[model samples]
Target: MLSETNKKILSLAVPAAFSNLFDMIQVIVDMIMLGRVSPVAIAAAGISMQFLGLLYAFMASFSVGNSAVVSRFVGAKELDEASKTTFTSSVIAFLISIPFTIFGVFFSKYVFIFMGSSEEVVKAGETYLSIISLTFPVIFIEFALYSSLNASGDTKTPLKIVVVANVINTVLAYTLIFGKFGFPALGIKGAAIATAISYYISFVLYLYVFLTKKSIVSFYPLFVKDYAKRVLGIGIPAGVERVITYFSFLLFVKMIAEYGTYTLAGYQVGLRIEGLAFMPGFGFTIAAMTLVGQSIGAKNYEEAQKLGWQTAKIASVFMGFMGVLMFLFPQYFAMIFTNDEKVIQEAILYLKVVGLTQVPLAIGFVLSGALRGAGSTKLTLLINTASLWFFRIIPAYVLSKMFGNVLYIYYAMFVETFLKAGILYYMFKKGYWKRQVKWKT
Candidate 1:
């Protein structure tokens, strides 16, 4: 009864969804352990993670570009070219990560201070940030490899790697955070070490897969300037999009920080819980990106368009169901992370408010991914940048100043999601991507 396209989408999406689910579970476990330590601990770790997101923002450049380009190559049956692009992209990503590592090691404390964190939080976050920063190159290289693998429809490999990595991270985090198994209790620092170790191990596993030729894209280690240009051409806009978006997110977090430690902790808990709902959407987004790229590569633009809409429709259903749960019983979710009454109340407000936006968020995720797959990164960049700033951040800023209520700020976010989804749907329907993409290589 299932169409071949539908089955292909699920084959990619189902594995990816489980991968994201495990990833979220790992983060939730970390936050749960940190919460047991104190609300300040949760705030410290949460802020540190946001600051670290800058590294991922930078990684987005090559990772996304690699996906857009390499997926097409795979679709066209050009395995050698895909391998070269993957290798070139990986090298560039590693080089880019070095400076970030140095900066994070030396200047992490300054980031906390700049974010207006309290002394306790600043002290707690400093070591964690520094330790996590050390893994930047590992993170960058592995993400590049993983993106290539997924583009080639090998999501299952990454899922396996993540499952093992999460197990290692969770066990190490629990042991080191609590001084179990004769390990000294390092608290936040322990969490950082666990994360760094898992990243390094995962990178090694990914590299092994490529070197052994177990993956669709092998580890060729060749640098092709033309290929690099092709990749970066598509990636730069995506990278800029991520950089600006994350910077805005940090600014958004800074605004939330003004509400005090308890509120920030609550927000962090709610974010982790909300991330659970994002798993299905994230999986389908990857599906759209890969399938669309492949379809476009085969010069089947109609199939590409159809695939995008199908993926978005499926993602909306899953995310909308999750929205219902969050809207109805946020406190049940909040309790899994922490027991503090004030924190629970703040988290409850956040979950309930954000619950309304899940379907729209799902729409935006998959369609933008589809656009990126069609080599329309610039279009996505424009849509995301304009929407984030004009609809979300600026409005949230004014509302926060006027009412001084985080609820109004959240409502601004809720409104922006719908607007962004509408714009993305319009662009996807307009079929601009069919005209925009002209394949080279």
Candidate 2:
């Protein structure tokens, strides 16, 4: 029998998990469709998506900060403050996206080339990257809205919105990618356009919900300097952390690229399939963050600790089970994305190696989210930077150079996940986040 607390956490987690899964499905659809075009197409889209992920890493800082602040206010019964935070966060996200949009549009070709992609892959990816760049502002806006809603304990609304958005995306992608229903075949460009369109649809829906005052948090036109500072104070460290993390990932991708296009495509496919494990981890992370933030806001430190551990425990079970499935059916999952025998073989290796680490990954995600919720972004930043660079990146680079084998890179990844998870669990037990000062609403 589940306790009430566990029920509340799962009430949020189930919907959020499905939402994240659907979000990944959008990309999986793209990969599957593009795989039919060519392995080069899959590789190109994968690299371009990584760059896009880098851009979203910046936006995630604001989204994360908004979630913490808004949830804290909600817990404290400061509805007005929560609403104001949502608006201000959205504004900041939009403003920050402008320069990134310009940079992405102008330099996407160079970025793909710099990743060591072949000429065909680079050309295939450039248009896709450029089109998606145009939607950067809306993407951030949607993030703000989702964060605000999730913080207010309304994960189901975002789940509904994402469902409709993905439906739109899938239809557009199918029609435009293959010239179905008399639409012109735009290849990779069609996938980009579909994604951008879906983003806009979600953003519009979010904006309407906020404006109509139907959401848990309403939009208000109050922008206090102190409030902005509070959000950014927590956010900037997160932003820096993500920027460094994604930059490191870019470097990792570059190293992977040296292995060849088929290898890169396989890695990308394995990564997407691996999202099955992450979906639950991410959902539980959100639950942990929200519940932890609310508990802290209400000055119930014990409850916060309990919620964090409980969420991690739940996430670990589900993710561990998923890992077992991944290990068992690695080849089957690989075949869903690509028919290339070499690519499927490589993806199978990645899936099998990474599958063993899902429980550790769950621990890391939940604990990190707990820390973030308590406004301990600086600590997380430090942990992520040190663990990622020292444990993951440096070891990976050295092992790859020594062995010249992609399997060694995956081994490094697996080892680093466990190391970081242990450190995060230890830090959570030490209770540093409880001592952190709370923002005044």
What TM-score, to 2 decimals, does candidate 1 have? 0.92
- Per-residue error for 287 in candidate 2, Å, reads 0.9
Q: 352 in model 1: Cα distance from truth in Å?
A: 3.4
- In angstroms, how far off is 252's CA in candidate 1? 3.1
Tens digits of per-residue lDDT for model 1, 1-47? 98897889999998999998987778778998998888878888888
Q: Please give the CA lDDT of all the candidate structures.
A: 0.91, 0.89
Q: In candidate 2, which residue pairs clash?
A: none
C-alpha displacement of 25 in model 1, angstroms?
A: 2.5
